[model samples]
Target: MEDTGIKIQPTMYGIFFEDINFAADGGLYAEMIKNRSFEFTLPKTGWLEPNSDRHSYNKESGILSIIKYSEEGANHNFARVEVNNDEGYVLINEGFRGMGVKEGAQYDFSVKAAKRSGDIQKIKLQVIDSLDNVLGATSITPDSDSWKTYESSFGVTKTEMKAKVKITFEGEGEIGLDMISLFPQDTWKGRKKGLRKDLVQLLDDMNPGFLRFPGGCIVEGRTLAGRYQWKKTVGDIENRESLINRWNTEFAHRPTPDYYQSFGIGFFEYFQLSEDMGAEPLPILGCGIACQFNTGELVPMDELDPYVQDALDLIEFANGDTSTAWGQVRAAMGHPESFNMKYIGIGNEQWGPAYIERYKVFEKAIKAKYPEIIIVSGSGPFPEGDYFEYGWEQLKQMNAEIVDEHYYKPPVWFREHADRYDSYDRNGPKVFAGEYAAQTMAIASPKNKNNWNAALSEAAFMTGLERNADVVYLSSYAPLMAHAEGWQWTPDMIWFNNLESFGTPNYQVQKMYATNSGTDLLKITEDGEKIIGKDGLYASAVKDVNTNELIIKVVNTLEIAQKLSISTEGSNSQQGNVGVLTMAMDNLEAENSFEQPMKISPKEGSATINEGRLEVEIPAQAFSIYKIKG
Candidate 1:
């Protein structure tokens, strides 16, 4: 039998699990609201007509039109109108409802207009109350013969009784107006902050070394056309690109939102964010077609050059210097120094033989130019001889740098398999659990409700990942954020409204595990009593090389609190102080709400080490980290 008192040195090959996919989508879900959709347009004439799409309006030539009658107009019998091109000028008419306007309450005028011929002339906009008093006004000409657009800004004084929009055309040219919308200005702007700053700080505290973007199912589009395209998101804020977010429907659990996304937060923004957070950039680019399997039918190898070129161009854009053409363009956009991204993933979840062909093309080209860069390939599904196994075999032939894996299961499944890769081959390509989450069949369940027992299961699974850190290179929770009103999927880590944000119990658990663990794996054993008496107390240990500090992570998933007596050997009493960081809740289903963000948080306390033995008490339904000076 192994000696219980023998001490083992921690195996230190850098143990923090990374490669957690932690990026938010740049879709309309995050960026645009109802007021921002470009569907609304106003013509030069005809009565305001509602188009099939909710936000747009239609008008014929030569007459002024009002699509949205002012809400104030019902009370005071007046309405305002707004019009603009896509790029710059917004013409507001404040006197349309016979001039007199309400005081103290302001009416907003807005429109969607496009330039048809010469630039718009004296595109004047004004806001006047029912009393013919001009409250505010603004105007501008457009820059293109193309459909350049703009939105005007003006407000009626609160003291004014009522107000409406008025438009005057000085130029003799035809212009189109889809809709001229009017409402309270405040109503149109909505709220600016969606996520809570504290939650963001909590994630930052984990000190992740790298963040894998965008998604699991997010990367896998529902249709070929909806896949994530990096090129679509870049440049100045307004001029940045956009796309239809595929995950929106899943989160919304309904028909997808009608509006397309403006990918303002694209690859460049992700790189910038990583830099800001002191983490390395790991960019995953699309390969060939999105989420569809080819059924082993190959696209003729010669025709795949465009896919290969995209990979090359993306790398160049990320790492090239200002002296180059694309680099110069990137500099002109904003960043002068190359972002120097070192990890590039080719494709997402490609699981067929055709994927091998596709990957081969990208592999040869990328390695030839940037041999130092690590290449990651998606391996989908493995049951010994599944498609994922085939993908892994191909990677082996190609000497792939990393293998990306993803999973989404019920909480119970996670608990049973959290330590799944504990026996994984250590010499193989690094394993990256790109995306994972505990999803329940039931919708509308509260975030804290462990409806499917996911929280406990995931905690157990994470213990395995941490214990086998040498092989499990990275991991992250999937579907990180879901806007409460706009959710497309469920069982997310955080949910937010315009004013506040809250973390789920599972999220708090993950935070506790991530923050308290160290980057070194320690070996430990349990007596028969330790195993038989308590089944939920999963534990792992690590020693910090620099500080010579010993950190032990203990998760007690029982319904009642437990007292732990921890002992160590080959260490002196003169090392340092012992402390315990505990994350516990009174109930298993306890959660944090927007109004009470700290309802479920970590608490710290001191631990006593008497004669090289440390003893601490852990709360019920909780996880704790005990740190002892070496």
Candidate 2:
């Protein structure tokens, strides 16, 4: 492998973040309770009142009810408990399938309360097991007449993933409680109010180039009225309104009625996360069209101005000066400067003449206001066929900067289609493989998998994406995460429950390519031609300008090892000790588990170059990266 002299763009390997499969509220938001603000449609979805059993036996036990304030603001609802005695009338918070607690780890418990009447003397907070045994306990005595904040801390003696937060009042009295919150002190970067440390660390390890967020179909809800409105996702957490997630019902696997967006990890947090991870921020907004999979509703062209305006306002919010209105809001959120966003997308998996009409309006408005901002247009869900071809044709005519494409096919489809982008026109709108993963069963099937077969196939396809770096500018795996028990979709890149998280073999493949991505593309050929599934091997080459190293990736989706002869043409002074990282599994279905997350992960080794060329053996069912020093 040697330098072909083609330059790979900095935004080649990135991430796509969507709020599906409990990825936001129950997974990444760091809040233990499911509906902490009592904002769900049921208002009591995640809460369980044990008063039915105990109150019947003793009338002294209290009854809990909800109170709703004026609906003008976000924190419009709170829970009210009327207690007659300390007979243990309980309010239990069934966390996202129960909170994950660790032994010797401290947790912070806080609440907002006011004493309206009665001797409501104390409020005790305890983390209890399924048998009602207390794991850790902390109490707060609220003697104030107006709403004020209360805080306390406790440490568990044992680790448990099915732990619940219990609240019991002492003495007879009337109390108002809102925002009963609990957070693990050990968050990512140890920020007081932060993301799940383990989950963020996995993303940080990838060294992603950019982060495209607020996504999938959530940006375009089933109805235009229910779309993800970024205006409502910024500012104070308590003030950020909650909405029903479009994926709340009728999923391919599990249907979650209690699913709602608290916006705890909102747009502001997304930009901050991108900054923390040292990646560019790419935000997608609605374009007046609802999800085509559902309603396929469209806002009349005459009334599409607001949707276009949202895109303009977002660019201002991300890269505006403090003197501007939206920039003032960004500054008040503690980031006085800017997110420095470079790309803005109009729709997700959208196409057709209607999409083109709306996209044209958005393009003119966005470019008229901010010419330097790159506009990412959309291609329909399927990566090929009439709609995809039509989108590319129309977008290219419009001189669109980038076009987003997505596909989820069988593992064989990936390996066989390694040259999917080879025929793409070099002068057309560049590609953004925005949402893609090799499906083992079917699209979003509960039985689908994140097995080694899918990973290796993806690696095979990625070589083609890299080989066409001039046209394919950005790529990412779809639906980045899922919760084991509460997930609606399978085959996610990262899997987690309440306590622990692990990356699948697919995730390892993504991380390897992203972290090892070089600055320039090179030619790695056998028989003086590009390698594409010949001998069950796929290969691509690149050069890292910063490190002065030439990198080559090889995927062997075969049952036997393949030996390659040395021939680098060493005329360009490309030579050195070859460092190889190989990821292989005995079985195609072999998976990474919580106990052994890296079971099928990459393994590093050194290979001495013979003379001027590097000779190596690629193992069966493996994806390997060779870093050659220059």
Best by lDDT: 2
Global lDDT scores for all candidate models:
0.55, 0.88
Residue lDDT tens for model 1, 1-630:
112232221211111111111123211123212323232222221122122223445422232333442233111111222223322323333211123333453434444455565445645555555554567655655444444445555555543423434344445454555334443333211412122234355456555566666544445455545666666566544444345556444443344343234454567766665665566677776666455632222346787787677778877887889887667767876798888787888877767777777788889998898888888788874323588778877787776777888776656666666557766666778777776766664433334343214665566667666776776666666556655554555567776553345667667667766555564666654773322114677776766656667777777778788888777765453334688777676665555676776676667788678877777777776767878877
Model 2's TM-score against the true structure: 0.97
Query: What's the residue-level lDDT of 304 in candidate 1?
Result: 77
Q: In model 2, what lDDT does residue 506 have?
A: 92
Error of 2 at 629 (Å): 0.6
lDDT of 1: 0.55
lDDT tens digits, residues 160-246, model 2?
A: 989999998888878899888999999887877679999999999999999999887999999888889999999888899999999
Report how far off residue 505 is in candidate 2 (Å).
Answer: 0.6
Q: After TM-score superposition, what is the CA distance of residue 588 in candidate 2 from its true location, in Å?
A: 0.8
lDDT score of residue 197 within candidate 2 = 90
